[model samples]
Target: MPVISPNTNYIRPSPYRSAAPPRSPGPTPEEPLPQPPPVVLDDSKESTHEPCWALDAIRYSTIVGAFSLTSADLKLLKKVPRGDYEDDDHHDRRITRTQSQILSRHGQRIDFGFGSSGRLKHRGMPMYALANAPEQELYRNMSSGGTAVMKPFSLRQIRVRFLWPLPRGEEPSHEAYDEWVRVDPLYTRVQLAMAVARVFYRFVEANRLYLSQYHDYPWRLRPDVFYRVWLLGLERVDTNVFVADLKYVKDYPNE
Candidate 1:
């Protein structure tokens, strides 16, 4: 697996814009609630998978077999298709095509660029459906013209930037410190997620096992630029692996 490349200077370039438009004068303009970081995992903390009779009893196939094997499996089972003979131009074109397709997909939220400090600035899709009549009215017009829903996709680096609690000169400024302590655990969980994602990217880049294939990794376009790309669970699906596999979940839910 191409893991996170060691070159810290290598910043991922943004792709298209997010599918969801920014919420302006809407969505309460409240800062997202802050959370904690994640606990690091080491070999000693890990455990073996439980024996599953289900694995033996069930015949799992993709929705009609997306592949006889996964890409990871291909990395092992098949020969690394000798590419020394292939022309670089031919391979480059194929990669570009794959990235273009991901960007053009209907519900994809592409991240176009970052702010001066490297913050993901714009989203590409329909604006959040504001309930304020005026704001909602604007969304309705955009939707009529076939606007995108919430950001369609996310980027690998984009993180969630929470709203700052107090203005720089607010009175009783230290009060929030007490509250911050209580939420330390949540912040830890989020950081753990970012750390794993950081590792995963290197695996992808180093081994050159690309999901994007050509363009940059298809991370979600959330508020933060270096955050996870997929939604955790806005809703539940019967067979989604994240829902089915508890261990893969990176959440530290706030009460």
Candidate 2:
């Protein structure tokens, strides 16, 4: 099966705007949060299901290590068709859709743009829903209204962006450091939401497989049956611990 293309420049282009929106009043306006460097996964290995599974195993291990999830939390995740994580275009679409949903929510809008240093600059909202909302809420919003085949590499890269704390700003001023500190929690929320969305997306896709087994001949699965199966997968997650991980993430030292 095709895996994510070898090209590693996976960051989606910043959302387009006619002109910069007016800044809303909030805590001392934060300098744009520092951006993470591009992730370059080694694609030298022969393209095969084994290599894909290896990468996916690493991702699952990383997720289990970072959060308070049991192996059982991913019961549904394991069911997703392994081949779905190979399309580059699908990855782009999902990322774009996710960004649009977050930015459109009722709150101060953020415009991500390249700085002179060629890094992402988060400008506009001091406290946006992406940073402030509960991870589960964000996940629910993000997971719905979209269907895209996501690749492991793309998913891994996106998670890394949110998983770790942002780098310190260049300015020596305390304000910059304060801004990083404030923005860290926001990332924590987004990180979990994005993870949830990833898993949810897989469950949605897995519906195709689940429905197929019921009949030897191809038939359109009823919407009710389709939704129920997908939702069942979600219901299996331990949301309490999932949310508690928010606090855990805050205290967890950033390496």
Candidate 3:
């Protein structure tokens, strides 16, 4: 090789040299990178602003036991003829006397009346007392001296789905949806327990005709029986669907 001149420019690649491009400067003041929106964790504000789908159903149930009275009870009661005071006065008097006797036996002072529609109505009791009277009276009437001990119905594990009615042309945000997904199961469990208790009491009222025929045994809903009501569920299926897993135990003392 000819002698290289001292002034000759030569280039050589080094194995350790990186081939990557130079990094650009960080975000400038004029055109900064987009920062994520701030996350809010105010539960009270969130709850206050939360949609009413869940609350609406709960309020409806509390004000009226379930949505409507049991159809079985309604059908049975409707079969009775409407009262014509001149014709049915004796029958109404007999019914009122029987009701007074029953209330006296149970130590309850509330009076019962036949309305113009011929429906049985409580004259001097609160709405809740009337709603709960049947079951309570059944137990009182059955027990000897009202001192008999009966085992309460046992509730097993309850599994429920988180569902809420979506308003027309409205949708839940990701945060709200996630919150509901987290809390709905718990809320449903509590409401279901309350509903089950309410239904247990109402069962006596709804099935009074059938129960009255059984005089040998205690006239109450069988402790081991499984009673279900669609309205007792937290929300209507059209709005929210739920499943209540119930298991009854045979623990009532045999007479």
Which numbered prediction scores highest in TM-score against the true structure? Answer: 2
Model 2, range 122-194, lDDT digits (tens) per residue? Answer: 1111112233335464344432312232211122112111111111231211010001111222243345333
Q: What is the C-alpha lDDT of each candidate?
A: 0.21, 0.24, 0.24
Tens digit of lDDT per residue, candidate 3, span 1-255? 001112123232122221112242322334522221222233433444434433322222222322233333333221111111133221211112343234343222111221222222321111222223343342322212123111111112211222111122223200000001111222222222333344333332333343233344321223212221112122111112122212111121111
| TM-scores of the models, in the order given | 0.17, 0.21, 0.18
RMSD of each candidate relative to the true structure: 24.1, 22.2, 32.2
Candidate 1 error regions (>4 Å): 1-91, 94-109, 117-150, 153-255
RMSD of 3: 32.2
Give the Å error, residue 249, model 3. 5.0
Higher-TM-score candidate of 1 and 2: 2
Stretches off by above 4 angstroms in model 3 are 1-188, 211-245, 248-254
| Backbone clashes in model 2 | 1
lDDT of 1 by residue, 47-139 (tens): 466233212111011111112223332222111111121333212111122334443544322121111221111211111111111323333
Error of 1 at 67 (Å): 43
User: What would the TM-score be for candidate 2 when compared with the true structure?
Assistant: 0.21
